[model samples]
Target: MTVFISPLIPVVIAVAALVIAVIKDYRIGTLIVVILAFTNVGGQQIFEAYHVFLLIIMLTAFSLTLAVLRGSVAVQGIKEFNILLAIFGTWSFLSGVIAIDHELWFGMIEYMIRAFLVLYLVYNSFSKGEEIFRLFKIIVFSMFLSSIISFFAMIGSLSLSVETLLSLFSTRFAGTIVDPNFYAMTIAGIIPLAFVLITEEKRIALKAFWIISVFFLMLTIVFSQSRTGIIAISIIFIYSLYNLMRKKRVEILFFIIPIIVILILIPPAFWFRMSVFVESLSSGARADTSVVHRLLLLRSALDVFLKNPIFGVGLGNFEAIAGRYTIDPMVCHNTYLEIASNLGLLGTVPFVLLLYRGFMLPKHSMQNPNVRELSWAVRTGLLGMYVAILFLSVPFKLDLWILLSIAAILGRKISSEKSP
Candidate 1:
């Protein structure tokens, strides 16, 4: 059926693109990776079994490794964070082996492959500041493209009548990205990038372009109607306001006015959705149905962690085994709880350390003013993503890895410049 095979379209296109890019020139791999990052947000859904982004990462790694070994490309020093990542990935795979349920083991293995490749390839890809700048261009362009798609999709869906309006608000704008929340998160993640670009660029035309881009990106987030997305935008804006107040007070208007416009233009349904959060808090614990389900899911994850405290119920086994604990089956919505449930304390420690190290490097990169400023944006974006994962199980999403790649590359660049 067309419905069943629709997902294959992205897979085939990605495969062809990867093949051509590799055959034409190895440097094209970076471009393809950028495409994969953008596509993964909402584009990968075309293929039900499509792990093309992972494939692209693996291929790029293999090609880059061959180039290095053959002396065609200079070898960059491996960072400690990458080694820690490898160790954690190995542990994750081992944990999967002892999993109580094997139905989803393959999917877990696939994710481990993608995560490892992202850590290794991103760290190795950029050896110079210029390369990082090029990557940044790709990121900015991708965000722009994604935001445009989201805005248009929302417009196309809008219709007359309260019935139509209600349905529109009920449905989130997916755009090229399949899931509304993920699309919104992607747009939200790019908010800081738009802000940084708006500040850093000197040209009046360019600044105006970024301003328009930022407005629509904000609109896309609003249209997606995701609480996580809204919170992510709030986080970015707060970070922006704090940074701007300290450094560039006059320019804060570029950010503040658009944020106010977005809040004012938001539909009644979105406001109601947001009110649920406030209402849930006021009503006491587990009062909201959605919040109650999440709490129950968290409890179920904790139960799994307690039962399998060492190796875990196993990777991908949480949903299968969690049914015993909860009336309805659910994946671990919280990333921390999911990691704890899947890998237990033994694996969770290294995994947490990997994330910590990833974060701290960016924090330390503040030595370079440019790196510091950009890192602030990247850090806030990653934080937003982490917040998002608290509501959705997206451990292997390519956009998160791309953000990590950017953080790792910036941190490494800073470290490399520290000379003997």
Candidate 2:
């Protein structure tokens, strides 16, 4: 006996939020984007009926448009990365047009367009330092909320009876995001942000809040049992440790002790699950089918790229074409390979350049102490995200775009300060 709330409830709430945001400031619209970025509308599918994200995006766009019309906005000039992204997007659409799988191409292109729009909106919504910090706080706080829910979900699943366990842990404690790997990667990206927040906070209570949030984030990622997520967090942790050792050696224990304590306190089940990674390391031994499966898909992606090295088989066509090579007929599972196979060398060049520019800006902008600390976190967190996505084919994820947008904003701010 499942009960349903009228879809109108969410609709009304979204409408009211949008209206208030419009009446307020474009910054409110920015806040809305940050809020929705950390939530999803589908799983068992109840929330899909409410179309929460779709409504939020549409309303945010409308609010921004209204604000612009009222002379409250000044459009910023596009940056180098924006140009590369636009070129990449055009190539994606052209490839989709010529794709052998018309239906899939159409659906994928439509979704990609919406994703770009979200990126554009979020990028344009903030032009000041305060707005960016506000957005960052919302993003970090949303991550904290997500981590708490996922921690509880994992605990609840652990307590379930054997007969009921299948239904619960199937999602592996994913809260709003459906896939455990996606959820874990999301939290891992936040780990660096949490570090930055903790370091910058002056109030003891606020510092404590970020400290607890970091704990939950670590616990959630470990509980997720995602190898990619764990690997990503390891990279971030090592980078943070290196920075602390260079600048604040005594403070290194603050991070190290908490992680050591968490590991000691975690249940034995966590160790058993983590052992899959160790087992898979032995050559010629397939401890997990997914490892071998990814290799097969990677090989197929290489074949496809070799066959169509110019423009690719076409965007969104890898699964359609690569299925012939793999037993399960799945995605390439590697973001770089997926781009190579789907968009080919032509599109791949600009796509790679986009990442290069996005990352380089933050690396160069570190001369500004304020921007350096924040930008470093975004840079390293995004690097971890890029590494994590190497094992998953989510090129159009909102967080990736949000991160790139943040980098671009930082670049713009830094450049503006340097100008006469």
What's each prediction's TM-score?
A: 0.86, 0.87
Residue-level lDDT of model 2, residues 1-420, one tens digit each, is: 999899799989987876785556766665666666655432213456335566656776777777788888865644776677777888888896669897767766765776677777777877554555556677888877865775666657465677565434233566677687887777777677777777777789988998887887777675566778878887877887888888865757767976797667556665655575466656635366777677889999999999989889778789898769976887888888888998998778987887777777777567776656677777887888888888888777777777887887777655334211
Kindly report which residue stretches of model 2 are placed more than 4 angstroms away from their true locations once superposed: 1-14, 41-51, 153-171, 265-282, 414-420
Best by TM-score: 2
Per-candidate Cα lDDT values, in order, are 0.72, 0.73
Q: List the residue pairs that clash in candidate 2.
A: none
**lDDT (tens digit, per residue) of candidate 1 on 210-260:** 888788778777777888888877877787788789986777898789988
Model 1: what TM-score?
Answer: 0.86
Q: Which 10 residues in a row give candidate 2 its minimum summed lDDT? A: 41-50
Question: Candidate 1: minimum summed lDDT over ten consecutive residues — where?
Answer: 411-420
Please tell me which predicted candidate would have the highest lDDT against the true structure.
2
